[model samples]
Target: MKIKVVFLLVVELLVVIVVVVVVVVVVVVITVAIAVAVVGVVAVVIAVCVLRVNFVIVKVELVIVVVVVVVVVVVVVVVVVLVLVLVVVVLVLVVLVREVTAEVGYSTGSSVLELVFVIVVVVVVLVVVVFTISFVVRLLVVAAVVVVVVVVVVVVVVVVVVVVVVKVVVAMMVVVVLAIVVVTIVVIVKVFVVIVVVLLVVIEGEQVVVVVIVAVVAMAVVVLLLVVVVVVVVVVVVVVVVVVVVVVVVAVVVTAVLVAVVIVGLVVPPAEQNF
Candidate 1:
């Protein structure tokens, strides 16, 4: 009789231990899935949006995305199979607990209904905890994805602004060099005109000097406008990049802290229950 009671106690402990293990395993699997999904989505975005920037980086990100997706799918399928097996195992254990409790109750003349109720309550609480943890994991995944997207968008915007700034600088440099060339030509024409007007007394030389002066003035105005435009663009781009980087950094830090908190919650509870 004592042996049977000890056996029943052992069985009950096993049931609780098994349920806790299953819960931990399921949580772990789901966490991995969340990580993979978040990372894969980020990689895909980087690969697609910034493909022209760096071929090697894009290719590497794409490969990572593919590997992450494959790993996630395999993990999910395995978790599903594991859950099914756990359900079967739990049911079998429940039946065994019931039979053992019945035999013990019949011999010891004690009610078995209380033990059954406790088992049901434990199972229900575990289910609720699992669902809660799952919900938190989902939220974490969404937060991580949002953080990544913001960072990526900021980076892309920075790249675009830098590209535009570079092009503007190149265009401005070309305009400045062209203006200097035009000024040099205007000076040469003036000297030639003086020589020609004095030596040859040609009427067309004065008109040619006037035309060259007007062309030089026009080039100077165009160069001034380009410089002003370039300066404004550079200032605006610098300000925007600074603001965006700050915002992205803050968002990433907050998201990371939240993820860490949720991970601790998941890990600590299972460990405490197991002990």
Candidate 2:
């Protein structure tokens, strides 16, 4: 009986030790997990701050690019307007020459209808170019929006495009009436910066599991950003190409007509010689 009682005592002591060891192990695990979570949160905060700084830098560079583009477009529009004016003036001179020569028994007038048509073409080209510039400016804004959303986690996004020099059309109208004088395109794409701070908290969950959750979330965000950025870049390129092609077509048509006018003005007079 004594031997059996001693055996029972030993067994009870072993059970207490085992329970104490398990409690200690659980406490240590919890402490380590808490520490890891704190560190992870700190790292996340630091990353967010760094990302914001980089975003600002990118924005400044984009603004500079926008300024350069605006200047180039303005210069191009001015040149086109000048060329169209020259064509009109030349057409007028030719018409006057035809009228005077006709009074002295010259042949039929060369191109009264042609002059009218050329004016119409010039006007159409001007409108299209003006609108094209506007479209590009708008696209730039959209790209910026995409950039912001991809870079940071956007809870809500509101994109707005404000036209600084929207009335290039009005300027073209003035050109039709008076002359091609107003050539100024001021485009300022103002993007309202909204940064939403969402602190990921795993309430009532194991710290290690929470860590895994954070990691998964971060990975997902990164993957999403990459996909969105690629899509945005592709779209921007295609749209830009389309608009550029239209601009090129306008240029080609205008040049071809100008060359024809030069040929007619030169060739017809010398060939006939009666006028």
Best by lDDT: 1
Q: After superposition, how far is residue 43 of candidate 2 from its true place, in Å?
A: 34
Tens-digit per-residue lDDT, 15-129, candidate 2: 3233223322322232233223223322332233334434574664455345434544554455455445544654554455455445444222224323433554465455546
Tens digits of per-residue lDDT for model 1, 1-118: 4455445544554554454444444433433443344344334443343342334544544454454346445544654565566556656666766687787662221123234334
**TM-score of every candidate:** 0.34, 0.27
CA-lDDT, candidates in order? 0.44, 0.37
Please report how far candidate 2 places residue 230 from its true position, in Å: 43
Worst 10 residues of 1 by lDDT: 106-115
Question: What's model 1's overall lDDT?
Answer: 0.44
Per TM-score, the best of the predicted structures is 1
Off by over 4 Å in 2: 1-62, 65-76, 109-130, 136-275
- C-alpha lDDT of residue 80 in model 2: 54
lDDT of 2 at 264: 51
Q: Residue 49 of model 2: what lDDT?
A: 30
Q: Cα miss at 253, model 2 (Å)? A: 28
